[model samples]
Target: MDRERLIRYLSLLVIGVAAVLPFVLEANLYLLNVLILMLIFIIFSSSWNLLAYSGQGSLGHAAFFGIGGYASTLIAVQSGLSPYVTIFLGGAIAAGIGVLIGLTCVRLKEWFLAMVTFGFAIIVQAITVSFLASLTGGWDGIASPRLVSSQVPGYILIEYYSILAITAGVILLIYLIFKSKIGMAFLAIRENEIEARVSGVDPVRYKLLAFAISAGLAGVAGALEIHYFGYITPEIYGIDISFWPIIYTILGGLGTIAGPVVGTVVLTILWDGLKVFGLTYERYIIIGAILILSVIFLPKGLVSLPDKIAGWWKRRQKKSPDAGT
Candidate 1:
């Protein structure tokens, strides 16, 4: 079979395994929690990857993430609506803010743009704590209604399946986008804005679109996380939230559909496994080292490792044949 077919089958297998994992493990509390967190990160990282794919990198995506959580929580509480219903509204709020940010940053150079986006998260945090203190609970945060209540007989399984389905749906949406005209425009813009503009692709329009979609999806992830936790805090916009997506996306494969998924899974495993050895800061240090090595050796990320090895073996075989002659 062709390589694409192989990838398709493999992806299906992974999804199937994840779908059944909760039942297989009998919903162990710790394991279910870990898996939930991983799924949330998968969404978060993929959202960040989408922005990056559009040639715009955000350092403060946690702003949108937190906004989604806060918005959903507030809406659910104030309106007495189900959390699931409010999640979309939360994402919409984030998308609006994202468009505003995109408008301001679209003209800036990479470094300036990064700094502005990074500072926006801090700004949002400050507003949540001080300006919006009345509603935001000012550092104390607020409670978010759960997607599936604990009163349900097998709530954990239900929640797990719901999140898994969301994960797949989001990924499928991204895949479809990548196959469409908008995706082509993003690639062109990323490669050369001047040329893309000449080619009738409006960089401004597409970039804003990217910003909105990416931020909205990130918000969805944050909403899910907060709902699962049944609480929210200013800490949701912390630097760690911002950085985790970057770590996962870069390690998986920048701009590729599967990069965030693979990267999040691998790093989550590594992070947890290493904790068994009682490492804290050392864990980050190791991650940094891996990233550096990856940049140098596997510039395309871990997804490309197999191809790199194959190329090396081919070169070795060719050299051996020539040497024998």
Candidate 2:
């Protein structure tokens, strides 16, 4: 327990370093740019993690993410409004859509829910490209206003700080949710639906709430990404976008607050590092292998790795003492 506390404190220290890292790096635009994407995905993956923790995993979270992006982008372009304000509107729109989807999944479990959510992304993509092509600009995409105009001096620095602030707020919000009754309901539902119902928990309400919160934040993350790039496209609903978060959460540690954070950081490093070495497709192969090993050996995910090693060492020492050598 003392060791676990130490690990947590160390994690906090690492976060502190990350908070000020851009300044230390002299705000290099390229580096800051990568960090910005990473931060956005952190929020993105964390949102998915929240839903999975609630026993309602989504394979098509990109639907909400793209919806948020399109919604915010259209609102921003149409009204000449700030992306700042429109992002929230985007989140709300995504949340509403999420609730509608959740209503259909009220009785679903596991593979059924996953398949439906996966199909939802495909459906949303079709709608964007066909039914809404006029507004969505079809496949050509459309411009989105930057969070901060590039004309400003040190705009990149300003943008980085602003995104950092947003990421911090989202993480804090998720942390609070995890510690509340809402989180408990999610856990109860995840662990056992019948038992959760017997305990007076309403799985439908909590699942919908989880879906709303998860989708809304995913939408915000998507909005921020496209806004950062100053464009929006239907490709934002790609299956990769949905899968990446699940990968991160599974690799990091499911159901724990630190899992997504740890997973995202480690994977991001490995991803970019592999790129530098020109691995291309091989990087994914390596990552896939790592994922398999994690599942087989470290079922609790990477967050529990240190504890696993520590316990092994303690057992080894005990066996050594009993050997009488």
Candidate 3:
């Protein structure tokens, strides 16, 4: 078999093993929480990776994320809809907004465009806090009904496995997308917009499509969060929320597929471990340090580290293989 097929099969085997892990391992509440949180960030980081890899560094993505959370929660609670359906609706709404905003600013440069999108995020947060009192619960945000109860050990296992399933599905979907012709188009646009446009690739349509899809996926994550945690607050939608995705992506590797997973695992472990030492608030410091070191030493992220090491080791072997003789 070729290298790509071998790698794909191996990766799938690993994921399949992980999906059934909770069944073989002992069930513990703390471990369950960690897994759930990891799943949440997995969704967040991967979606953000799509946009970042596509060359649109949006700082305002939290707007759609917040919208998705609120929309799903409100629909589930107020409108008396199923949590499942509301989730998709929330994502759709967020995506719709993304389409509009992406179309509006598709022409802007990276930094300036980021700033404009940041402004939009700020606006969304403020609106959620302001005179939309009846709808948004004003300033405090809305509280959601619990989607699960009892927190039994079996239920915890179920939740863990459910998250595993969702995460797997999302990762697979994205992997397929990136493997297709559209993924190549996105990469071309990222590498050089001028050249892509000159070659007849329509930048506006694809950028808007990416933005909408990214926001929609983020919405799915946010909605799942509300259901998983059984609560929602405006604070969750604040600018503070954006930092997590940004840090996770940068720490993992900006463009590589595995970077987000690596980043999420490392940071999640660090965050949980430090809580025991009463350094919970300092999670950001460690994460920031990781980001800085990642940028300085491994600018492509941890995903590229193995490849670089392998290349170096091969060169060394070629140079010194007969030394032992």
Candidate 4:
């Protein structure tokens, strides 16, 4: 089969597995909760990947993530709207802020841009706790409504399926975006901004667009997470939250759609698996080692491992005849 067709089939298989996984596990609430969080991080990681695709990397994505959560929670509480409706509205608010952030970042690149974004997260966190404390509840945090009330029968199962569907939809939307002219523009800009401009691609426009979309998606992920946990805090903007997506994307494959999904799944498993063995803080050491090794040996991320192995095998086979001679 052709590569594209194979990928299409593989994508469907993954989705199918996710669809039936809750049933396969007999609706175990613990596993379902884990899967739901996994799906949310997948969305979050994919959003980071999209920004990276535009040749921009952020170190403060938690800014948007927390913003979405706080905005959605506030809107839901005051307006008495469903969490479902407020999630998208919160995303929209994040997108607006993302555009404003993008304006300052379009001219900067690499570490400079990263530090700016990192600074924004800190600034945002401070604002949330100090300035917006009246509504946000300061360092104490505020309660959030659950996506589905626990009063409902099998609510955990319902939440899983709901998040799973949203994850699939988000993936599909990202796929479409990646296959469009906009995707091409992003690639060109990433490769060579001057050349892209010469070719009539507006780097500034596309970069802002990338920021808006990426931040908006991240906002949705954040909203989903807080609603799932039934709380939102300034801790939502923690450094760890910002770094997780970057780690997932780098380990999975920076530019590929499946990279975030693959990376998140593998790392989540490894992370939780180690905890089961009472590793605790030691798990970070192991994970850090693995990430370093992956960078040195599998820089393209886990998604490229199969191809790397295949090529190595081909080279070995070619040398076999010479060795005999």
Error of 4 at 22 (Å): 0.7
Q: Write the per-residue lDDT of candidate 3 for residues 1-325, one digit (tens) a residue.
A: 5968877887788687767666556666777778788887888888888887778888877887788888899888888886768888988998898888888678887898889888888888787877666788877666775445446547666666666777888888788878887787789899999899898888888888888888888888888788788778777667767778887888888876777777887888888887878876587687677678878988877778888899998888789968546
- Candidate 2 lDDT tens digits, 1-325: 9976886688578778878898798877777888889889999999999999899889999999899999999999999999999998998999999999999987898999999999999999999999999999999988899988999998877877788888878988998898899999999999999999999998889999999999999989988998899998888999998899999998999988889988998899889888899998899999999999999999999999988999998888878956545
**Candidate 1: RMSD to truth:** 1.7
Pairs in steric clash, model 3? none
- Cα displacement (angstroms), candidate 2, residue 100, comes to 0.5
lDDT values for all models: 0.92, 0.90, 0.80, 0.95
Tens digits of lDDT, candidate 1, 1-325: 6988998898899999998888798889988998999999999999999999989989999999999999999999999998888888898999999999999989976788889999999999999999899998998888789999989998878888888999999999999899899999999999999999999999999999999999999999999999999999999999989999998998999999999999999999998888999999999899889989988988898898888899999889888857546
Best by TM-score: 4
lDDT of 4 at 200: 99
Candidate 2 stretches greater than 4 Å from native = 1-8, 322-325
- lDDT, model 3, position 272: 86
Instruction: For candidate 1, give the lDDT of residue 58.
Output: 90
What CA RMSD would you report for each candidate? 1.7, 1.9, 2.2, 1.5
- Residue clash pairs of candidate 2: none
Question: Residue 61 in model 4: shift from native, Å?
Answer: 0.5
Candidate 2's TM-score:
0.95
Better structure of 3 and 4 per lDDT: 4
Stretches off by above 4 angstroms in model 3 are 149-153, 281-283, 318-325
